[model samples]
Target chain A: MLLTALFVIVCVALGAGVGIYTSRDYTASNAVKPAVEGFLWPNPRIIQPFSVVDQHGNPFGLENLTGQWSFMFFGFTHCPDICPITLSLLSQVQKKLAEQDTADKVQIIFVSVDPKRDTPEQVADYVSYFSKNLIGLTGTEEQIAGLARQIGVVYIVNDETAPGDYSVDHSASVFLISPAGQWLGLFSAPHEVDDIINRFNTISEYIKKQE
Target chain B: MRYSSGFLFFILIAVQSVFAQNSIEITDVWINEAPPTVKILAGYFTINNHSDDPVDLVTAHSPSFQKIEFHLTETQDGVARMQKLETISIPAQSDFSFSPGEYHLMLFNPVKTTKAGEMISLQLTFSNGTNIDVEAEVKRSELPPHHHHH
Candidate 1:
């Protein structure tokens, strides 16, 4: 009986160790599904649902992204620092792409966390300063919040959470949604434009192979 | 040898004057560019006055534009406002600035777009009727607000 008990404890210990070793640094909130992998790379969080309006006041659903890979960031125009830097980084990517004469195969979308103040015109003006082709999206507070939830982008407004009274706290990752409207992958903060372009190219090749 | 010694003595005096002379140091400078460019950015680094007396910043001029003044931009309730301070005081043997949203060297009304890798010259006027010229490196868009900055 003593020997059997000792053996059971050993098995439990090994099982626990294995579980930890495999999923270290991973979050349960984003672990519901294994990210799809393609083009010699692993794609994270490959599919999510959302609905918002574009700068043109036109309805923009996830389905609208079906034909082109979209790069999405969550932020507002009033943001003084990080949002602009990230947007600037995207702008750099676009500039870099333009310099290479790469035909527009990608889309850059900005989703405002400060929906109350970032009117469609304001959002357009803010983003246009960085890149003319960029798209800004906003909607009712609840609508935007629900859509951000569907994906894993998190934004924390100041304690008040009231429009025009708080600052937004958001994730810094740049997400890549495939042409099929799938959440193909995400590039964590400290994004490099080259890496995004390389990954986009690699995924395009994979998608082509699949087709 | 006597002539060389005199020349060396003169050079030493010149060097001493240069070191003991009062100078203003500015760092982490930034400005906000919103509608009306009201919110300018200025941060990081302190001003050290080695002189024996206090120094006052009378005004600041940015060479990038015809108009560059000493102003503070504050954001409240989605509205950004600017305030012009009469003077910025830097006590002797002490430092000032290196603080956030306070005491900034604002640059605006650019004569033209400021490109990267170009040095910007800012003329700083002090209370002692002295003008110190300082230079700042041009950095790309500072991240939008929301992240912590000092």
Candidate 2:
């Protein structure tokens, strides 16, 4: 009877060791897996304190970006082709993430380059047409430029002889900001909903593992 | 079924030509509806030249809009910019598609608020003294309403 009991204890110990070893292997494999297809910086870029206003005329700055991951795109409301299209696609991304039950922690911010024309009320109306989850922001040229420069978003207002007959040439890239208010990476133009969601999930998992 | 549909499309084109005397025929006309706060919108369509000679589209007129311009959105070094074109030439038996993110008609200052699902009228004038009137739907940016490509 004692011999049988010893054999049973040995089997149990061996099984437990194997289980632990497999788990260690899994962790090591996951750590080496790539997060997403973004141009991830070697170090997270820190954002400075630049004041802007939200669609509701509330203060929005670097502090507001704390505690949540953000995807920000720089465009104006009057941009007929790219701005509305990008915002609409981001809305689809938000909806898909919500359906997957992962969008509660993510935010999409639309920062307008033409603060002279895009008032808070106008921005509010424009964003509400797409999705309530989107946050619209605009500010004075200097303040907006400060934030734009930090993220490498460029915009130049064209000169037109007729009033309201010009366009603003701006960067068409979507930037990813970490939950700790650091610029994480950037996704280039022609963003797809499925690709964005998968990349976001992968990045989130990777960030959690790193933490 | 495919042959029958193709025949029907040809018949439809014949009928359109009978009415408009087609020097330049436009199909798949659509306009991207602007947000409530925006005053500018863009129109997309395909222009087909049915004549034996080339045709130059000189101007676009829309009574519903204050001004119209032929604009193309081009990206250079990741910067999206708009370039206004003076005219677009359609060669004989050739087609030019004014699609989104490419060549489009920029309609500014809408006389009436244009929402999705509404139709607007546009008149296109050619350098050869030909004009074609077309009606297009204002579509949401996400949903491309029509994709009838040949």
Candidate 3:
């Protein structure tokens, strides 16, 4: 009976040790894995303060991005193909969230790289076609570049073939910012509705666990 | 034997002409309707060449727009750059699609504001002296409506 008792004790201690060791190993590996796909979890970049104007001609800076998730896309109103497709996808994302009664948690922002042509009034009219809740932003060339550079957005204004007619080559990725106003990460081109929502949910859950 | 061979040649020629007659086909022609304030729009379609000879799409024109050009949107290193394509050559017995984020017909300066469901006429010219007339319907971006899960 003593031998059996000792055997039981030894097995229990070994099982507990194995359990602890495996869990520590699992966590060590998971620490390096990204929180979610397309999310910069370990070190989300801090967004610097910059001045720009919203669709209403009101000054919008990093403060406007606080307290809500922001999905920002960089494009010009003159972009015929990719811009519209991306904006429409974002609208669907907003609509899906709204259906879940979580619409207030996020905001969609369209930043025009072609500030010379995209005036406040023009942006106002352009965004309304996609969604009434969408926020359009444009500023002077230098001001726009300041924010774009910080966010790693690259854009170039092409030479005009005719007067007032030109194209702007800009990044097609959609940048994600947390409610804390940190640059979370980006969703690359060819974004789908469900894929974004799924990743957003995964990131949100991960963040909740962190808190 | 000479007369029989001549008859066979005539039959082969007739069959080949029939194949050439129904070689080039354009399908899924549609244009994304833009806001009235926007001057540029994009059109998408698929061209299928069933003939043995390759077809080169040289240029396109539209009566509803001031200018139409073949523009290719290429995304490299996260940057989306657009270039004007002078001609798009489709190999024989192959299909080419001008879809979103790829090759598109860049329509500029619409003569009038076009709404969804409106029809626009386009004339696509080929290097082989063939012109194809297409009627493209204007469509809003196709996003699924809110799901009603009971």
Off by over 4 Å in 1: A1-49, A98-104, A160-165, B1-24, B27-150
Model 3 gets an lDDT of: 0.89
lDDT of 1: 0.65
The lowest-lDDT stretch of 10 consecutive residues in candidate 2 chain B is B141-150
- Residue-wise C-alpha lDDT for candidate 1, range B18-105, written one tens digit per residue: 7655455555554433322213234223577877788887877775766554545443432233355678788887767633333344
Write the number of the candidate with greater DockQ, choosing between 2 and 3. 3
Model 2's C-alpha root-mean-square deviation from the true structure amounts to 7.1
lDDT of 1 by residue, A68-97 (tens): 878888876655544666787787776666
Q: Please identify which of the two predictions, 1 or 2, would achieve the higher lDDT against the true structure.
A: 2
Instruction: For residues B1-150, write the lDDT of model 2, one tens digit per residue.
Output: 657888999999899667447557899999998777688898999998888888899999998999999988887777889888999999988998887767889898899889999889999999878888999999888532234432
Cα error of candidate 1 at position A162, Å:
12
Give the range where candidate 2 chain A is weakest over 10 consecutive residues by summed lDDT: A33-42
lDDT tens per residue, model 3, B1-150: 657988999999999777765688899899998978999999999999988889999989999999999999999999999999889999989998888888999999999999999999999887777788999999997542333510
Error of 3 at B3 (Å): 10
Report the number of the highest-DockQ candidate: 3
